[model samples]
Target: MSEGLSAARQRDLLIATTASAVITDATLLPFFPKLFATAFGVEDPRHVGLYLAATCLTVMLALPVWARLERRWSTLQLLVVGQLGAGGLAIASHLTTELWSFWACTLTMIVFKASYLLVYPYVMRLVPKASHAGVIGLLTVIVHLGGILGATLGGWVLEHHDPRAAYLVMAAGDFLQMGVSVYLLRRGARAPSPEPAHEGVPEVVEASADDPAPALPPIPQRLSPLVRLGLLMAVVYFSAFITRPFFVEYWGTRSSLDGELVSGWVFAIPALASLVALGVQHMGWSRPGSLYKWLALIALGVAIQATPLPAAIVVGRFIYGWAAFRGLVDLDLALFEISPPERYAEDYSHMNLCQQGGVLIAFWIAGLAVNAGGLVQPLWIALGGFVVGAGVFAAYGSRFVAAAPSEGKAPEEVAPC
Candidate 1:
């Protein structure tokens, strides 16, 4: 195949990868705490806690591997192999009855699932830079929506059928994605890397014989403000996922709590809230209002969990859904604005690493909190984290935005996450 991505081909990459994003996250959500009993003999929250911790480490370590491999091979190629491998692992984990077998297979699959990290760059390169935020937002929506669908499916399957059935569905979904990736490979033209607007221009300066040529300023190799913003985003994402794994068990234990399936719906409220946030954003809601609004929503969610009331917990989650979506999406857009199109993959890989690090820390805190006080402490931790993140952004965001060379930077595009 020759280079240059077609519009239809970009669409395929987006659909396949977005679905891939959904299945992996969705496949894992409902199996925790509830399903741990059947496979591990101990249904304690600690097991799920430990498992998520392991996922944190596995993906953290594995993401860099994918990033490195992408430098040498095709991202689409890695995605193809990763999907098939992850699919087989999902299916195999379903087959294994042993706890050790399950954990090993599941965690290993996450290592492969790290390939999902590359999809950002995969689609980023496939589309023009101008559309980056829109694509990212749509992908973000699909991802959250996937979480809803996955959790609902997992919960429903567990309620009616065997827990393993959920994995089977995930496996089927993975294979379908793999097929899509393969078709993109076989039929689509090889997408060309972007060339800078001034790439071929000669650096000519008119000078008189008596006038010596002035030395040119060096191109900036490092963007410290952008790096700082990236860190803030990492924290935001970390704060977002900190309490995610425990929602089912957290809400399920309440006296007024409905059932496993209902827990999925409860978990899904944030995604719905996210859609609302996106609509508000699309409608030209004020940009300056982002930081305070984001912090408030996050604080509300955490405070709700802290209340000891189950109904409060539900209310908080909805508030948090909106908070997480807007905060994460805006921060990502900030990064997009600062990034160069040529370094898109490399830059996002670094961003991914930072976000993964935050998630890893979240898991560590989550595991400890679960061990100490059931599941409430992590919310406290996440709340504190959100506070720190919001402060960091508010204090430094304007400076960072000011730091950009207006003419040098890419155009800022707004999209949902």
Candidate 2:
């Protein structure tokens, strides 16, 4: 291993890993649900719901395992293994004839997916503490841009070729990502580990040799006003996706336009919103006091989404996407400001669990709302959640400001829990 590689090399590796994950996600997302529905010969979208739910469930289940493995293996090793595993699974998913086999392959991919999800924390550890906002902003830009490209390419591939072909393309992307990871690892380019602030604190402590283990962080006990606020943010974060399953269902039942085309537009709304968010970050909206401004914008976005027109729906989605990005960035900054640095990884993992759990809950609630009311019910529910999320931040935003970083240190930064 080279003793002296530039910081740039390490960041480049992180970006490559991040970009690969985004590409892989984008490649699969557009058509996987439809593929499963077709393969199972199920007409109702809810059957496809199980496929999506399975991925999340598997990721949640594997969180502890990912954490444990990270202690034993390098981050690069984990990234390489995950990419190859997920890629191979993507290819295998195309070959499966039985629904059970499909489900099993999907679960296998989920194990890799969970590790891929850890890229954020892994990358955070690589960058200098003072550059947190900039590095995070750049990382978000790469992921979103990759998302845009992947979704666009995946949609195009699906339009011109078979769904299986689309999966093949995704598999190829995963392989390419794996190659990149292997190259970085072989070249001895790795992310910088977070340095300990005090002499007694070891930056990279191993699990105890004598003791067996302790219990996972209890979800209820981990819930604080801030964590609760994070849950609300999760609601808003996922509300954007709540209407996704129902897009085809609602369009087919109600609208005159082509269901597939409209669904594409619906997906594009978030992508467009992400672009606007990138712009906001460029405008320095990431700083303190900007949270309220973004929340107000989110409220406006919700109101726009509630309008009846299809164009309004698309516009509303774009606004919400932008708002969602800002909301998440601000909330993350707030969380870091208040959290102790050493406990950052645990806190972040807890918040991630909450966010994913919230998504699962939102999906269920949205389904019920649609069953009871109609297509528009989920929108209203999401709008309410965003309102509450914004309100919580506004109410307690002062607590965060009071805890801002001193002049010598970086802006109140929280380690990723």
Candidate 3:
């Protein structure tokens, strides 16, 4: 077997992954509403909400299919094709003279976005098992860094230039990511072999001929622990996003703050929270049972967000963002611990689908709540969901916490890479 990845190769992989992630996040969040508004002649937040629902549906549907395809093709191959498809579709949206074309482009983006899902499993395979949590945490931080940069850069570009220009810049980043992925694959293929495998033996041979070959486990069955962790993560993601649709609606009815300033605060809060997530990574409070601690912090952040003053809301939003990021990091590490190598993509896909499914439900509920009641009502609902999710974890999550391998117990032998 090859000894291990060199530091340079690891760095290159991280850079490439970061570039791809940033571009994907940039395209979706800050720029998408603007793009849809311009291209479709629609400005209602409800329309944007519908588009998000469609995108989420597409991603959820495509993931299982993508996971199956990943079993047949290499990660590098899938990633390159995905990048090119996404970039091309994004550029094509700008060429659309009709609203239908924009819809078509969005649909195509769902297919392209499947590529972004593969990166997590690939990174997990590359890192040492002992360092799984730290590496996963680092990767999550990189992803947030991309999100932070993409949001800031997209905002700046949109202000200084046209919406189409933003897509073009994003497309350029996608193409660059494709190039780096190709290089990585080529370099990997060309590297000299260290040794030869035994002629018939699998890397992780089964113990008995009478034993049936282990079936490729279904996503739900293979990842029960991760599913538990995902339940908690879903709540966090849902809480953060449920109130999003009503931000503009809420501000529109208010008289105290300038409309633009209020909008800025809404966006700025998450961005500030992202920065806090980065800072918290170094603090060493990320072990098991950390979810409950972060949940308490998130509740405090929500309480602060409920305050009447704008300054308190801004600070609270930052805290929410911080807690959200920490929750994600811990949950991701937990997932890595529970997932088996053979089912990595399938397991990760399921976890993501679970999170997105919760997001879809929250968005739909929030939309209805906004139409029925008001903005503040949805925030209160999210707070309740967070509390309930934390309670569930506190009650049932202790069984899965990472622990030292016991005396006289052999380490679980993973299947061959």
lDDT of each: 0.71, 0.64, 0.64
Root-mean-square deviation of Cα positions for candidate 2 versus the true structure, in angstroms: 7.9
TM-score of 1: 0.85
Q: Model 1, range 1-417, lDDT digits (tens) per residue?
A: 545657556666666667655855585575576677765577666667667778877876787778788878887788888988999998898899888898889888887888877777666666765787787777777877777787787777888877766788878877888877787777654546766556543432435789974444332334465566666766776777778777666776664666877878887888887777778878888464556468767877877877767788778877888777776676777666567666666677677767777787776677678788876777888888888877665555465433333323454442211
RMSD of 3: 7.4
Residue pairs with colliding backbones in model 2 are: 336-414, 344-417, 345-417, 347-417, 348-417, 349-417
Clashes of 2: 6
Q: Worst 10-residue stretch by lDDT in candidate 3?
A: 189-198
Every model's TM-score? 0.85, 0.81, 0.79
Q: Which predicted model would earn the best TM-score?
A: 1
Residue 329 in model 1: lDDT = 70
- Would you list the rank order by TM-score, best first? 1, 2, 3
Q: How far does residue 332 in candidate 3 sit from its true spot (Å)?
A: 0.9
Q: Is 1 or 3 the stronger prediction by lDDT?
A: 1
Deviation of model 1 at 383, angstroms? 1.2
